[model samples]
Target: MNLLGRGALAPAVPVFRVFGAMNARAPSASLAPDVASRTALAVHNIEVVYDHVVLVLKGVSLEVPEGSIVTLLGANGAGKTTTLKAISNLLHAERGEVTKGSITFYGEEVHRLSPNELVRRGCIQVMEGRRCFAHLTVEENLLTGAFTRKDGRAAIQADLEMVYSYFPRLKERRRSLAGYTSGGEQQMCAIGRALMARPRLVLLDEPSMGLAPQLVEEIFEIVDQLNRNEKVTFLVAEQNTNVALRYARYGYILENGRVVLDGPAEALRDNEDVKEFYLGLSATGRKSFRDIKSYKRRKRWL
Candidate 1:
């Protein structure tokens, strides 16, 4: 049932091979938290480059409010993963660098901190592709998340139980090699591992990729529960706008590495442009819009 096959421990599985760059000027703080006091993670106009030539992420900016779920939505190759890596400082390994702008977490400059330091500060990024240690057991992979922690064993053990509570399927596969687990279980293992880090902010990349619709819903339900019950804030980058918006309080739509639109999730669901361009709907799903405006007055989405 291993839908992901033998991918090994590639947490940030590379999907796109190309990168590009442009002059990145910090955008206005319009997207910064309305209450600066509640901001957990902030990225201001960052430019990313690969191998000092190919550039990606042209001055992207956004904010994740403390203890809130925010969805970053876009199509494939929209620089979503790059933005997450830019914040986690993982770009360096890929010959990628944030050539412009800044990132802050809990009011501390993230560029100045190592990846481990960010984890220590309760910031973690659960990379895409549901990467699990192919040779290791599910429990072992989950324990790896706590490798940077020096906290007492008791706390870690308690957290392990908590992860099991959130992902019972992972518990069922606890002793199985991660490589053999189903795609859904591996995805659960990835998120459970991040939880072991006790992160205050989790940058989740594509939680719904390569799974059955039912499994996707189940995982998202767990995410919502974790957010509500544990106060774990999430900034999820996903292409599945329909599912993501259901749980997110706010959303930002990115296209070609730029913020094209952003607003409360409900408002986005009603936007003509979003409905057509992102949702693939041509004002045909809802009849209320037609009732509210004449056909001639309806805004053009394309």
Candidate 2:
């Protein structure tokens, strides 16, 4: 007779219980192997205040592993940029303070370091609006980023070539005044300047803002390539969720100075709540998928 009570239904209760226990044990025996760890940059609970009266960041926490691109998504005045500034220590420059919590860069405290000190230690920020010296030549603007280095001229020249390789258009405008180039070209220059610092992580603020569609695509492509090939980490603050999510490995959604949602890029792409709010989708609309697609087409044209 089978132990499963096949013959005359012998001890049906005991046989079924034994089979169930064996089934559970089989899966436990075939468990997946352990995974090697990935290097991660951790941001603990951090808070920022402006002028000792107004608060910006409130108990924000996130992480970016090595060789990953992270994005902070938010609408206007949502403290996304403030979080980037706090991470890079730019808030201290403006007398805006980290009133609470500590920041660790590669497991070391970063809140106490000066901006220049941080740059030397491999962290840099490319501010919003592509702030470049308009009258300066492209080469000069790039040279400014290497002021901290005492290396000889040939090494600096090699670094410039590497930057130009990443942004070929910047090489085409190498001798022109930054003011004379188009908006996209200026943004490239700003990023190239940041790269000259030889930073492991670059805090980019609104890199896609105020640019034409083609240029925005070009810039995002470069950022993606850097993360893939150069192993450069990124923490970008962007209003354009569609573009930012395309390049980021992970993302955090900020609203009114608080992190309301955060997860892997693939997860957020499918999240209904993120689509409704940050991705600018109509949560209650009854439009069909075709209609939604048509609406997005119109938005791109506009």
Candidate 3:
């Protein structure tokens, strides 16, 4: 079954339609790695314009190394999703156009490639919402992701089984309509569907959104597992800074559509400005309150 012909399995949401801007700031050194550069994907000075006038992305730049997890963190309308769209070249409706900069994938320039071509060339995106077919069964949805391939039935079947292995709940509901499943299960189905394409780099957008805390943890664990075990690189855009930072080896902080900060995950985790602003930590008395409480407890005990 040709997935595109049926339209039943077509990606419902536009793959990428990123827009918006972030606040301006200086780049910090703690975020930059000292080791030799290794970029699986690089977005260099890219600018996106809507309707050939209003600009959304402003000179955004970041890199994802081979076999590692990198995250883009920002608030809503920070152009996180737009950045993904620029990579996939699906910037329609917003009349979104990339006027400046280029996106390179695996050392090849991707800004000129068509959306379908990009998918065929080893890059696939698992969109923000769990946009699985509400009427289709889980098995059908997974098969749809592989529509671009012309492999034998046996290989597709094996891959389908692998998806089930990674997400057992998807197997349990293989025959069930996607709409009937819970949010987390739908998310699993979405990711499983993307994996069917056998991508070299997976662009994950807000995979943890709308799930419970436990489910969020599970999702991040799966992401980490894919990077470690499958050796598939990832560039994820997430609103949940803590979860993304926890799993990502490197991170880029976007503010007003620009790369405000870029660095290793550990450094972003400990940065004072990042903690105070992006992570919403109180810089003035973050530990002071805890220390004061501890001292009071010790005095009473003594």
Clashing pairs in 1: 20-55, 20-56, 21-55
lDDT (10s digit) by residue, model 3, range 1-302: 11112222223342222222222333332244523545678888999877675666779888777777889997666678888888888776447889999899988998888877898887898888889999999889999999877787888888898888889999999999998999999999999998898788999989998999999999889988887787778889998888899888888887557676767888777876567555656566454334434334222211
**TM-score of each model, paired residue for residue:** 0.83, 0.81, 0.82
Over 1-302, each residue of candidate 2 has an lDDT whose tens digit, in order, gives: 01112212222222111122322231110121112424335677777777675666667777766667888987666677788888888887666788888787888888888888888887899998999999999989999998777777888889999999999999999999999988999999999999988888989999998999888999999998887787788889999899999888778777556666676777677676566545656566533455555335233312
Q: List, residue by residue over 187-206, the lDDT tens digit for candidate 1.
A: 99999999999999999999
The lDDT of each candidate is 0.79, 0.75, 0.77
> Once all C-alphas are superposed, what RMSD does model 2 give against the true structure?
16.2
Error of 1 at 260 (Å): 1.1
Worst 10 residues of 3 by lDDT: 1-10
Best by lDDT: 1
What lDDT does candidate 3 reach at residue 83?
89
Provide C-alpha RMSD values for all models, in order: 8.4, 16.2, 10.5
Question: Which prediction has more favorable TM-score, 2 or 3?
Answer: 3
